[model samples]
Target: MGRAPCCDKANVKKGPWSPEEDAKLKSYIDQYGTGGNWIALPQKIGLKRCGKSCRLRWLNYLRPNIKHGGFSEEEDNIICSLYISIGSRWSIIAAQLPGRTDNDIKNYWNTRLKKKLLGRRKQQQQLHPATTVEHDHHHHQDHQQSPTSTSNGLSNSALERLQLHMKLQTLNQNPLLHNMLWPKLHPFQEKLLLQAMNDENSNNNIMQLPLLPQPIMMESPLSNIGNMMNNNNINVSSYGGAFQLGGGDFMMGNLDNGTTSSLVWWSNEFETNDVNYDRSGSFSSSSNDSSWDCALRSSDDAGLF
Candidate 1:
């Protein structure tokens, strides 16, 4: 068997409640209370309304000091905060605001507050437009595999990867991105440094070569990367709270106070050992067989290891 309807839909007066009906409901509830039965309360008040309707009308409207509108700033903050935390649980949110009802808060949010927030977002977007880059591979004309060129032959994706590697090197050097106020080592200089650090076979040869000049006041690597991407019709964006380079294949730690919490490297076409970089420029891997060990330091600091 199914549960019975609360009231006869045909018999109950629906839509907006009248002033006379409101007065009757309020006066009866005030003098004698609901008598603990809203279903029978309508019968006592002689009103052609459903029990649920009577309860809502009393609790949301006719109740003492039921605030109608003109929601204050403090109320708005509470509503927004609760909405963020508990979502659209209006009754629970309303419990925090003494004079407000769930219906009022919900209606206000849907009608006015939602649009207001969206308008502010639109304004912010207009002021500082978000960067969204899309790479299409069908446009590549040739295939050439080299240190600088992949099978795609300098495609947008390859360029993105190069830029990502460059960004990683930049972060590995400073970990502060542009905030360090330090000059960036050139791409050639970075390559030389990497070779000098990683190439064990050429350690004697590298030692004989003249040392690279210390980096001086130059453009920030971040700014340089941005310009490069913009010129190539691509842009950099943060991914999952981490500073991502290019299409997010390489992600660095959060740029918080010149300190990196973590770094992760990913490749779309190759399987490589996952590496983690910390603020100290030390690298570690989860794989046991991996022997990758490198430490990148700033020019002003000790030499790279």
Candidate 2:
């Protein structure tokens, strides 16, 4: 059976809201309260908004004592810690923080706290880091270097670093910048990625990657050592070592340290000299395709879409 619509879709206002609508929602809620039914509240207040939109506006923006702008270190810690513990349960994380909504917390994490974490991770690597293998994603000649061959240069700790570096390189390809942002492997996934590596190193040259603990088999660009990725839907392609999904870059460091981290948002700016993509990630020049771009963006946003 099909699901019911939240309200009469044709009759409601959408997109960025108007001041009048805001005032009406705020005033009505202030005077009488939501009565635990946001779906009905819009109609009660005589505003032409879908109940979900009305609820989001009120909960995220209009509600009393709601804090807007600038997260504190405490809030950031709360967000990051909760994220690491619970994994993007924004509503739950927001509850631990006073006056912050799930949307607000989510936006901050996506745009700011994410960068902060990457910056810190990068710093830690500088002090006691993995030997990074560089690969150029733009030129096919550069990709010919191959991740396994790149790691062949590493004298110490080749096995662990080699597996993660290959996995990161295989995750997506923009540059080393893109690998740093690949989906953070779940505990099970991290094990699985390395497991695939161990199995390959001990025996075969190429192997198929297992799905993210589900029923389907996943195809990954990690076709070199088989495939490497941590998600079910996260389809990736490998060109030698540089994996290019959409943003076109990737880097992995120090996974053996077990300082577990997951994919947040892309933290770096796109290079303009030769690299270019719009907010939607469609290539502006000839040979344009954004299927991977669309896939990663949707996964990054989770259910927000």
Candidate 3:
């Protein structure tokens, strides 16, 4: 069935409201007020305009006490804090800020403040603590150090002597091997070694080797090897080795360590099939289409989500 028209079309006043009509509405409203009833407002105000038109005029342009300008730093901070806590509840945020509309605050936050805060956070996290500490320590020790000694715990002179000793030791032990290995190792390997040493110094376990699974031939073979690998603190290297042994065609999957039966089934299925599956790409496309359809349905139901 077709829907009815909004209002009776025969005698309805259309187009721009004249100054005379506006003045009459304004005068009547001044005397008795709009009383928040747009439907009855035009009748009370003695105007030939619809209630909806009057409401739109007052809200969009004629409303008093509205603030229209760039936001201050304090307002920016308040908006940021509110956004983090409440997400996109702009109406609640607008209520907290006097003279500010929800629409204005939303636009400002999305277009300006969000990007600036993210950039500042990234910059702060990139500063190197080791370089900063060393520079400060050197400045402090320069004033307090004597000719023969230094104030720092591991003094500059002592560090230099230890470095020279280490160099001499390196020359004495397999000099060619040391040079070749040191130069050949990637920076990532050096960083890993440093991290491992730090963990050891702090009395924490540093995993150096990969754990690979052994093939066990049982009558039922109901147990899941992936679950066992996860329950134990197995490393990625071990995972790679296990992957190779299980037949290099199985796609990497994450299963609960406790669900041994499921894991075993999955591994067995993959081994038997040995088929290349690009399921992720298809799944993503389907999800996107579903989301778009949901959004369209929501829009049809209401003006907002």
Candidate 4:
């Protein structure tokens, strides 16, 4: 082994100092003021701790007049601005907040500011409600006009409009589908889908959707068949035919000629199937499905499905 460690490696005390240790450390530091070498401070202080431990104890725990407890409104503003500007550098943020330690600021931000920002975002989204590119641009303009518009809070209308525009934009961007699929969805269903999409969207444009609260299985298998007939656009020439249902279900009815995919929704559920057509004309179905099954737990929950 190399030479023994520089400092004693056994029975070194840890954690908050006792009153006597605190007084000894404070008194020694008051007279000598660190002397530019932490490795020598503990010896000078006549304490059991090593110099490194003494420095940590002083800076982190026993520093005179350390500000503790909740941060004020001014501090909250500074922290938010710094976070938006610099990301998660807690030490940098702490420097701007006098008397506050980095750990303190970090805790307050995690516990208070984060929740406030999330709530403000959700409320803003609910209020503005945009559904198109033009609407989002208009809302952006409105927000820019307000002098007090820091990222902390924006005009609720603007937020809502941006959210709506984004939702529509996402659906539009997917050439595989169309908005007509949801043309006649119940208001609650529309809201649920929007919430889910918002949660999934990387832009943080909408509040996350809560986990499904209950389970929903189709009341009858026929419900899926009916739903499948209403929503899909069938390509009669390529795959023999395509089918879709009213509640956002779709299917390709025949696969022998190359059409064997279908999407189905029933009892507030959704699923998709890829069927392989054999030379003998038999179609084998392999399905990949997902749905808000919880929405069917009770009649009151039906709106979400």
**Collision count for each candidate, in order:** 0, 19, 0, 24
Single out the weakest 10-residue window by summed lDDT for candidate 1.
Answer: 130-139
lDDT of each: 0.48, 0.47, 0.38, 0.42
Please list the residue runs of candidate 4 whose C-alpha ends up more than 4 Å from where it truly belongs after superposition: 1-6, 119-305
- Candidate 3 lDDT by residue in tens digits, 78-195: 5654443224557656666667877777666655665444333234225522211111223445344223312222222222222222232344443222221111112222343334
lDDT (tens digit, per residue) of candidate 2 on 56-101: 8988999989999877765665565445323455776676677999
In model 2, where do residues sit more than 4 Å from their true spots?
A: 119-305
Backbone clash pairs for candidate 1 read: none
Regions of model 1 farther than 4 Å from truth: 1-3, 120-305
Instruction: Give the deviation of candidate 1 from the true structure as CA RMSD.
Output: 20.1
lDDT, candidate 1, at 104: 97
Best by lDDT: 1
TM-score of each: 0.41, 0.44, 0.31, 0.38
**Per-residue lDDT for 263 in model 4?**
26
Error of 4 at 218 (Å): 53
Top-scoring candidate (TM-score): 2
* lDDT tens per residue, model 1, 143-243: 22113322222322333333333333444443222332333444433554344323422224332221122222222222243343355444346544533
What's the C-alpha lDDT at position 25 in model 1? 94
RMSD per model, one decimal: 20.1, 18.7, 26.3, 22.1
Return whichever of 2 and 4 wins on lDDT.
2
Error of 2 at 44 (Å): 2.1
